[model samples]
Target chain A: ETAVFQTPNYHVTQVGNEVSFNCKQTLGHDTMYWYKQDSKKLLKIMFSYNNKQLIVNETVPRRFSPQSSDKAHLNLRIKSVEPEDSAVYLCASSFLGGRATGQLYFGEGSKLTVL
Target chain B: QQQVRQSPQSLTVWEGETAILNCSYEDSTFDYFPWYWQFPRESPALLIAIRPVSNKKEDGRFTIFFNKREKKLSLHITDSQPGDSATYFCAASNNRIFFGDGTQLVVKP
Candidate 1:
């Protein structure tokens, strides 16, 4: 069973367009994270939310923002997508403020392509 | 700056042979190290992990060897099979986790 689910498994959009990716976790985990994996397969943390509280922001561009409606849902919105914004966006969830021992559960990932 | 570095961006190993992937980190605060394995079109999953207090951790055929003084670690896959072919990532965390660029491993039968 997939504990975390992401919508629009693949997205293709034009430059300067705004796109939003939705993520939901059925695991009831308190913490959700957004990560971007570039073509080179470098995974970077973009945002982390615990109980709707923004805990970590990795100095991402202002165009990128994360919104959490609740503990189970965390969404990523990108305004004016650029060529560099084309990458795989992954959503993961884990227990809140817990030791790193708990492995993060990840969705298949949403691949974004900007033309 | 890249905190965690993985070597041999790609590796090819024969069936039943042992494959070793190396990784090193620069942050001393990173007390936890985890290895993740990712297959094509799939999300990365935790394979094995080791803490600074332990020198080695083993699960099934996967093992993680850690060296705190050297700030280095390595993953060894014993009796590797073709199914083991995938991209392996090394991640370090103090408070937030950081992943290495990744190492693609191809295991041929």
Candidate 2:
């Protein structure tokens, strides 16, 4: 059983359009994260949430935002998307707090294409 | 600036040979080091990890050689197989992880 899940496996949108990607984890982990992989395959952290609390926020553009409605769900939204914003976005979860573990379980990524 | 750096953006190794992937970090607070692998059309997953307390960690044929003083670490895949062809990422974590640009490894049979 896959512990982490994501929706909208792929999306193609025009520049300036708004896009949203959804993520959920059934692993009951307290920490969730969003990562961006550019065309060059360079991976970078975008944001992280722990029990719905913002724990780590990278220097991302204002157009990008991470929304976590609960401990098990985290979403990523990009407004006024630019051509350079096209990339594969990955969601991951990890155990924190009392059951702290550094191992991360990642979901199949959402690929975004800006035209 | 990149907190973690990986060299030889790409590597090619013959099957049955040993492959080494290198990594270095700039942060001293990083106590946890983990290596992740992603096959084509697949999401990255945790492959192996190590702590500052140990200089080496081996999982079957995969081993991690860590140098705390140099802020460096490396992953070695022994008896490399075609199935091992993928992108390997090196990362460090305190509370969160900082990943290096992945190294794409290709194994030739």
Candidate 3:
């Protein structure tokens, strides 16, 4: 019953390497998001896209960037990975202003391990 | 500033007992509240939700009690079971969503 999907369930890379995580949602949602969860289980929002338009960008590092091709596909690319970037990157989707509002459907998450 | 906040970073409860998870938010503009649960090694999914218009929302054994005046909410899980053990997240939304650090719940049988 998962409508949101993520690639590279687990990736291990060294510092200064580039990593890209892809996400797609088939729920016809108008919004998508990327969240980083650290080992402490703290979930922090990185970016949010509404209909392929960048809407919310938290205080993430410049090395981290988000891309959106359409309303269904959103991707995260880290230009230069760091030790602090080793965490689970979760992708989620939701609809705005309706019965389904405020409910988020999340993917399995892409776990990044920086060496 | 952290808009949404959850209490008891971790909790342990006996089976068949009622487990209460508390949440509060700083933004009065937030109108939607949803509680999501995540099991180990799995992604989070919506467990229950409530809006400011209603003070309570219930579904089976899961119930959400909301307080618009104090901007606080609580999720009560009754008849707790081992399978109910997971991390519960409280979130507030106003077009943009904000999630609180989850409360890890452990139900002992």
Using TM-score, give the best candidate's number. Answer: 3
For candidate 2, what TM-score does chain B get against the true chain B?
Answer: 0.98
Evaluated on chain B only, what are the TM-scores of all the candidate structures, in order? Answer: 0.98, 0.98, 0.98
| Model 1 chain A worst lDDT run, 10 consecutive residues | A94-103
lDDT of each residue in B1-109, candidate 3, tens digit only = 7899999899999999999999999989898899999999888888998889999999999999999999999999999999999999999988678889999999999
Model 2 lDDT per residue over A1-115, tens place? 6889999999999999999999999989999999999888888889999999998888999999999999999999998999999999999999872124468899999999999
Q: Is the docking of candidate 3 incorrect, acceptable, medium or high quality?
A: medium
The positional error of residue B109 in candidate 3, measured at the CA in angstroms, is 1.0
Highest-DockQ candidate: 3
Q: Candidate 1 residues A1-115, lDDT tens each? A: 7889999899999999999999999987889999999998888899999899999999899999999999999999999999999999999998853355646889989999999
By lDDT, rank the candidates, best first.
3, 1, 2
Question: What TM-score does candidate 2 reach?
Answer: 0.96
Candidate 3 lDDT, A1-115, residue by residue in tens:
8789999899999999999999999999998999999988888989989889988898999999999999999999999999999999999988862235788889999999999
Top candidate (lDDT): 3
Each model's lDDT comes to 0.91, 0.91, 0.92
* Per-residue alpha-carbon lDDT of candidate 2 for residues B2-98, written as tens digits (9 for 90 to 100): 8999977999999999999999999898878889999998988889999999999999999999999998899999999999999999988887788
Inter-residue clash pairs, candidate 2 = none
TM-scores for all predictions: 0.95, 0.96, 0.97
Q: By TM-score, how accurate is candidate 3?
A: 0.97
> Please, what are the lDDT tens digits per residue for candidate 1 over residues B1-109?
7899998899999999999999999999887788999998889998988899999999999999999999999999999999999999998877677789899999998
